[model samples]
Target: KIKNWLSAPDSSRNMNEAYGKLQDGTCSWFFEGEQFSTWKEEPSFLWVKGKGKFLLVSLSSIIHNVDLAKQDSSLSMAYFFFDGRDSQTELQLHHKLIRSLIWQLSYREDHKVPLPLVNLYKKYGHQQPLDRVLRDRSFRWIALQIEELKKCASKNEIQKKLGKLPRGLDETYQRILKGIDRDYWDDTKIFLQFLAFSKRPLKVDELAEVITVDLGSEEGPAFIEDKQYQDPRIVLTRCSSLFLLLYLLNKTSGIIKLSHFSVKEYLLSPMLTKELFMSDAAFTNWVQLWNIDLNIWDQKRSRDKTDVMKMASALYYASLAGIKPTVELLLTNKAEVNAQGGWWGNALQAASAECHRDIVELLLVNKADVNAQGGDYGNALQAASFHGHRDIVELLLQNKAEVNAQGGYHGNALQAASARGYKYNVELLLINEAAVNAEGGYHGNALQAASAEGHRDIVELLLQNKAEVNAQGGEYGNALQAASFHGHRDIVELLLQNKAEVNAQGGEYQNALQAASAGGHRNIVELLLQNKAEVNAQGGYYGNALQAASTGGHRDIVELLLQNKAEVNAQGGYYGNALKAASHWGHRDIVELLLQNKADVNAQGGEYGNALQAASFHGHRDIVELLLVNKAEVNAQGGEYGNALQAASAEGHMDIMELLQEKDAINEDHKEEFSTE
Candidate 1:
């Protein structure tokens, strides 16, 4: 429970896994380097800088040496591998570094949790379960504060360069590319494209198998028996600098990966513009041929489901890329034209979305389901409509595509066309009876979609077509609130003129006034207020206009809300009240203003419980001092981390923690004196 509560990343486990794969004498040359000796002797930083194929393996050896030195000694050691492939959160990447280091230092020897950690756990453990409470607010707050530390660490670092090495990785990669044998150049290009454009890292055998099959042959994707390498490892030897073991999964069966992400970047980039990498047209042709051939090969190998998926994916991509020849070839090879896969679903939808007129015609000729609903924009018509592909929309409509079909991101063709401000597409869809008052998708109805995007012409067109102006749904509820929130003053006024409800509460920001205030649209706020908008309407992400304005650091908007009788002591939203929101976000002027307006300094609700705790947790020392001076309750406890001290402790905000401690001690002394009196 405690270990889980600590929330240290499992990078130590990753380190161990990599370390276990390290060969005994690998990177032995690094140990003999002068800078390595200096690093071992000194407390100062020594960066082992290189663009070598074996950098990861070398680092593993160094970590192993560090671990060996720490054995049976008082020395503490911690190491973490930063894998760029993993989508680590800001808290996990930055703050977890500090947490993991502290956890390691405190508990590495004999696995005992330090007294401070235990005290922290005990302090908040009673409020909720150890895991939930530890993570609730503390991690995010600490992560934000540690951003400065990350920036500082990035500054003025010394890097030890290897002697006689190429100054940059690009230069090294260039030389390696040039060094590939002339005989193997064509094969190597095919080998690299398979790696570069592959969905995931291909295994060594898989790569070899693909390379053995010749797609450009007159016989069509024939296997060259003599060209096959006996051992899978020999395939890697042909591409020297590009084939280092990129973190093996086990001893025998290793999953192959690019030497580095930069290798792929270099291959795809224009800097290496040579015969090594094919042009867009050539690459598309290659890919189309390869996909078709690979599918047949996979089918022969008895992997029918996987092969069909691959074929469908290829057809979708070929259509999407607007490659006529590729699409024709794919279809010729019996690629499923109506295959339900990829972002835009079928080949027809993909081609339509990208405005590939010829391909759309080709697909329709092949009897693709014109109204097929499955992808990002639902049907081919919706996809074409959303992307402003008028020609494709016309084509789909001519072929009996459904205009009022509701499914995708923008709901239907009408809504999609409206959101994108495609007037012609909107008109075309409307002409085809697209259900003008359609309600669904990201923006609910066409009017609100148009209004949200500030498409006034579309808004007018919709209204003129008797589109429901007050129809509620989508991100901003009604058109008026959407217009007001987006700061489209003209649209807001127009919607108001159309009798669109000003205080119509629904969607993300609840109503126009609060949305306008949150977005810092003072003119819109003023306009809404003039049109009888409710000043104290609550129910958005922020409780009310005043809280929203304060949270957004909109001083002018905050002042306007205050003048309009906005509540200062309102208890709702992420931070409970305007004061706490302002404090947490480091809006000192707004904090001061809220305090002046008699906002509760000891208000206990929201994420950090009180204004002082919110400020303390986020490292707002000035706000903490100001709140303390304004007589914020020092002992108040009930939100994320119990009290201000605990909040400060969670983030290691020493200055705020000390200030809180002094105030708590002073309050205790005063209590004692009062009791005696």
Candidate 2:
């Protein structure tokens, strides 16, 4: 691919055409310019250096020992002339190197030279004398032309050449402003600013959703009509030149990015941004334009109103972007410091969540609400804790933010920090007197949260800090259950050593043993069993430990449980019995093992009527045959699809149906003879 690109005609074209294609959004802006000599015979290592607008390609070793003696004289003279006269920047050094190679290729006639060089020699050898070319004024003029081509190739220079150079992102954006119809200018400008300043690339649908939100209304942004959610290309049509869709290898998934990295640089440039707010009037106009109104409106009246206020203001975007100056400018213009809307809820939360310490400090100084609630993380502290922003957490804490505030994904700041395994932050929260037993979040409390994530150190810390080890609340019921379910044997052992009740029931999986069995954690299951966990103790998603292991097709666990005297025909839980559960999932080996252990083949319970029906329904012919040979009642009726024959027939299994019918007929013959006797 590199060789084909280097040899292509496009490589020889001037930068003007290349930059034109890039700006017009007709070509990708990833052009490569060779910076190192390719004429060397040794293995060449290509090094890529990204300069202002173009990628400079160079070689690690410019010349092999064989080529050096032949090509050294001419190449050295060119380099000496360019190097001694001027102190060149890296880009300029690359330019000089490329120009010297062009000169060498233009005049050299040696057949031993590389093919690309040979081709160039064939084209330009007759035009100039090889040795005297550097001394000739006309050859110097050709050098000047190549320099001009380099300038044209630069994205920045291309913009300047086309008379489209804006002082910064705002100026370039103003061009987009001019092109948009006045009706869309307000909403469109807001959307463009988000595209320019967001921390991460926005999906096409996300952009659409944000723009249509009326930030001015207090009741929250109204959902735009479905018709307004048009294709992404349509949304970006007027300013298509400024954006490009970066398609993934799948071609279906893509995110929007600026056409060139320079575009982002221009937007972020301090000089250009300063020009945007040179006057109070200009600043106020920008503020008003960017401000989202948070006033509530009558639903009936709002439906007819096309120009709803935006949900996020300029302050929100500035905070999200970490543009300190823009944030200061918005604040000075009285952009609401406590505005409660948008994805982050407010500017302070956005800054805190993003870990922009300077911005967070600035917002705090501006008296932004440190305890403001309502967003994904519920408040700034929780957001900071969730993302492990220790500095931000410290700052918020110093500002008298509530230490025990209850809200957000993890319920509170401590739980959030603990869940994510932020040990230092968890320590900080604990030092600040964060509630040790705070409940009500994703993981019921800090201990369970730590246990669920397998953070042994955090679990130890919580336990040492007097956390309720056997505290019965959370997604997994308690810390021990949470650890066992996730196969965290070490944490489970720790919880157990801390005196967590081994038989403690109440979670998606009833107890520690059942949870371990369901998760296929044989070691944890064994440990729980060793610790005297009730093997037949029922009550969870699966009723018993043996059934749980059977449901998960853990044949070893099943055999181990049976060896420990687990009831083979025990009933209860999702599949009703161990044999039924094993048969349902078509684990032939487990089914045979259970049958050998004298599991009642005619055990009539569970989602399927019996073990025979469970096997037949799932098309496990061998298990069905095994069960039939063991005298499982062929006509046993009871369960979801009626009987074994009906179950097989319902699932379109003809062979199982034939076997069941043959067995039923034989049973009928036996019954008839007994009745006659």
Candidate 3:
């Protein structure tokens, strides 16, 4: 279920359709040619350049040979052949290709699906039906999951097989239609009509349910549930070769689509059009029966004509749904295609964000602004790149989108792409002259964003593009500190290799060493120490690495810092010193270790002047006793509460107050004896 729901259905039928007609040894010329030999020998993409209808047929032979050769070996192979005859299928051609490849490569000896795919399924599967799970957003999400896969060679070249004249196609389709049982004529016609004009592919269950809707009933259109087929699979038998079942993994019934555009053309022919119920009128009836508004899917359309935002929302939503006709209708009615107020700002950004490549092109052609800045991503390019929509990103770039236009949560397209780990988008943006080190956003710059997000490949790419590794300004300051704070040890090493300054200070944790210590990442701490990070560097909330570690109760880290000769009495942060931080935080073990390392018992400099006062104010009696035993002044003056006695009294710690009083009394008696002497 996980694999099937998450991956594209296998393209075996498409491959078989191409392979079945080939003569066994016909493609030997290409295999023996230099192009094939070079591609096989090197680990690079093979572009079989040519200009003819026979090119695809020959390529199919090569794919089959490669598949057979790679089987049962360490090498794995996946292939997709694009057919552009059907405009509807072509809308999702890239999706089908990517999904098919993902499914093919996911197979393993243990038969376990990859964790990322499983997680994607868990997130989007139960929230919607299986047919609805492969929408634009989720498709982009899964594509980004394995964008690092080997490059695939593709062509928009038409195949001669599907380009046959209408006469031959009409006869082949007509015979299949005539062979259907007379009893199944009405249902079969409705099925064929649905496939011929549906917005997207329909699942068997959905089509079966749609067939039960009585649009011409005396009572307004309603689903006659009793009219539904007992078994949805029966629809396949009714249509035969005219339709194809795209079965997903682990499922019996699957999506139903036309076998070819020729079948659609035959169905919509002058002679069969009326019989198959294929017409704009039939689609209108469907729209009415399904309760869908033709102009917009949104129910919150503006009641008042003057409300521009609400009026513009219709166009935005129409674009978002990838309903080209609705978008056209709204645009024809003077809808604001460049209106800037929605989750995605405008029609162009919404379309771009959702991977609606055609709609994006439509809007751009309709004069939609390419660089109008607003909303979550600021502009279309950033939104497209952030969501891993490479086609849309390229479209936006080609339309003159400012690659360095900064304003969104991610600041610019490069940072947005980098943060999301969309390396392909990042590469595309870099190639288009995006400022790799351009600053201003949540993660400061592209390198910091990639590093903070643990996208090593993106980090490497940014570095190769000359990204500043030690550049500061985000939540984690620089790339190295971000990686360290996030416990990304490998990224930390990479940043170091790029000459990231180990002691560069400026974020919430000041330096990588302090950030690592505060995060309790011992391995990163060791790495930083090896790179000569200043152990006693002071400037963040916790003063130094030792204080930060102590405050976090990271005893192991504190011990490591002490062994590294960290100043036990280093003072300059909130809790004054390491002992004061540990005592106030109730880390008795760390306090003991700090004291043993000779941390000044009476060091005064932070919110709590001394360790005793800090422990007393917090009512950590065990820590208080430990501090007292270490000879911390019982009446130490100066701190938030003035002294240990007053600090304990203010917090209403009776046991601590009494202990402090007794210690004070002992000191007083000693003072009197000394005065008498």
Candidate 4:
């Protein structure tokens, strides 16, 4: 089945089939003696020797190794493919498009390189076209330009012969140089260069002498310090770190030759990246015949104590060293693959928790628990979801990791994903059929979690996927209250639009309106009001919406509630009137708004004494004056405010006393002294 991309005229885009159909059909520069044929397009792309079905493409000298000599100059990038367009543009844009291709293949640990875009024709721009049509089909030109730049020959000298540069080079190479100058993570070229030297011996031989001739070693640091030593290779060598490795290789030829030999035998070995230096399995096997303990998984431990901590540490160090340690090494005789540890986790737990899909795979292959929960991570899958490790989550799900296992931070992976707004992991879990409404630990269900965190997109996704909008609240995850509290106007709009219970209340906080009022979110209060959220629905520690808003000192919220007909003198909470409550906290705006809304001047709050006294006690002189101007009682005894004089004296408000004097208020009738300091 030939794809459309294979029919494209762009050589870089249609390389595979086009090159495959070539008369010679030989890329001696790459797979010297390889042949290609066909097989049934089933479920795999496993290329076999002498089979015309499987074919590979070389991505050509990705980096210039003329400078970085310490590290073996890795030349040549390779991958397999079935499409012809991948071959077409691939040929033309092969050199310059290296940066774009590397990014398209984000080679994180577990999700191995997409060798198909290189080798497999599966997702090649074979059929459905995308917006990005790669232009700078001149990676080789960029390489040339970089070489010319290294010469430091002045512009006229440099531009003496070569024609105009490609547009992409003009715009991008300078930028890439700027980044390399700043030490960014653009090492694919360097990495590919390293791969090149390590694989092809002839290529290695061609570059070795030029790169390894370190004249700087003789003059030490000052040798290359000469104005004559100003080579662009010097800069690239310093940046790419090839010079150091080459220097080391030259300094210690024995180690280099041995490691190089090992590379020849196992160029693609994951073990090489790790400390598991089994030079060769055959060689090691022969030595082991002598009863050698080739156990790389050695660690001191208590007999019954599985050192998950130590195992994690080893795995961590291995990854940093580009090592791929397996569960076989992790779970020796009785290392206990499922052993639990402290807060962090057990073996399976830690892998899942850290979203270390590779480690998790090794453990699961060796029988690590997937559903088992009792560590920092709720479960293996849950841990992956928490960290937004989508690939790891997919791996776990493929291996039958549970979708709704609970008992971690928010309970399950779904809720965890929702809490973090991990769109990819959330989608992965959902695609794997994660329960949307299933409660996770104490955080209710996925809907509640996404709503609480104001993750509108996730909430909309959940709602679209049919999560019950009113799935009863959890211990602390009250979806409606949470939306109201954070003033998440859009989330509130979404929930209400989706028929979420406006007056819903039954968790740590009660009712949407009260929560909104307490949170001082005027817009959310308005949305709830629009949705018919009860003006008096009460629950949380603060009681009704009026009291909640008044106590919260939310002047705007108070006015909106009043405009929505919230009772001003409504006696609620330990403090009675909203006016007295706001006044007690010196919230002058809320106090004045309440007064303007016709709140009673003498509305004696059970704990607040009266508006004037409450204002005086909190040293809200502005509030005291507003109340007095509104004809509030001058003296109100008992409760937190004590008496008017006592409250004013406590706050040291001489102006309040003078205001009382100006009002011809009698201090002889009532008197009380109080001291806090």
Q: Considering TM-score, where higher is better, how would the candidates rank from best to worst?
A: 1, 2, 3, 4
The Cα error of candidate 4 at residue 345, in Å, is 2.3
Question: Any idea how many clashes model 2 has?
Answer: 13
Output candidate 4 Cα RMSD.
Answer: 22.3
Q: Rate the local accuracy (lDDT) of all candidates.
A: 0.73, 0.68, 0.73, 0.54
Cα lDDT of model 2 overall? 0.68
Deviation in Å, model 4, residue 571 alpha carbon? 2.3
Per-residue CA lDDT of model 2 for 566-598, tens digit only, reads 999888887889999888876778888999999
How close to the true structure is residue 138 of candidate 4, measured as C-alpha lDDT? Answer: 60
Residues 1-677 of candidate 4: C-alpha lDDT, one tens digit per residue: 22233432222212322332333223322221112111111323433333122233222111110112111113222232332212123332344254444433333223354465445456554556454553323654456466556765677866753555435533433333334543423232232233323211112222222222222344321111122222323423323331122322232221111122222233334533232233343222221221112131132323222121122332222221222332344345334555554344556665565455666676777776777776555676776777677887878778787787777766789987887788888888888888888875545788877876678899989998899988885643467776766557778888888887887767645777877776667767777787778897755656688987787556777777887887778775656667777776666777777777788988875555777877775566677788888987676556664567666775677777667656655545443332222
- In candidate 1, list every pair of residues with a backbone clash: none
- Model 1 Cα lDDT, one tens digit per residue, 1-677: 66667667645434433543565447645653435644644657878775323565677667644442222335666766655433223123566777677676766433577788889888874565578564344443333334324534433421222233354556666766787897887767777876666544555666666665666788666656566666766667677644334445445445566655556766877876465566564466446544554434543432223222343457777777777887787788787778777667788888887689999999999889998989767888888887788998998889988778888877899988888788999998888888999889878999988987678899999999999888998777888878877668889988889888888989878989988887778888999989888888888878888988887678888988889888889888766899998887778899999999999899888888999888887888889999989998888877887777777777777777678778862333233422211
Candidate 2, position 506, lDDT: 84
* RMSD of candidates 1 onward, in order: 21.2, 20.4, 21.4, 22.3
- Count of residue pairs whose backbone atoms collide, per candidate: 0, 13, 0, 55
Backbone steric clashes in candidate 3, count:
0
Clashing pairs in 3: none
Candidate 2 lDDT trough over 10 residues, lowest sum: 56-65
Off by over 4 Å in 3: 1-312, 321-323, 644-677
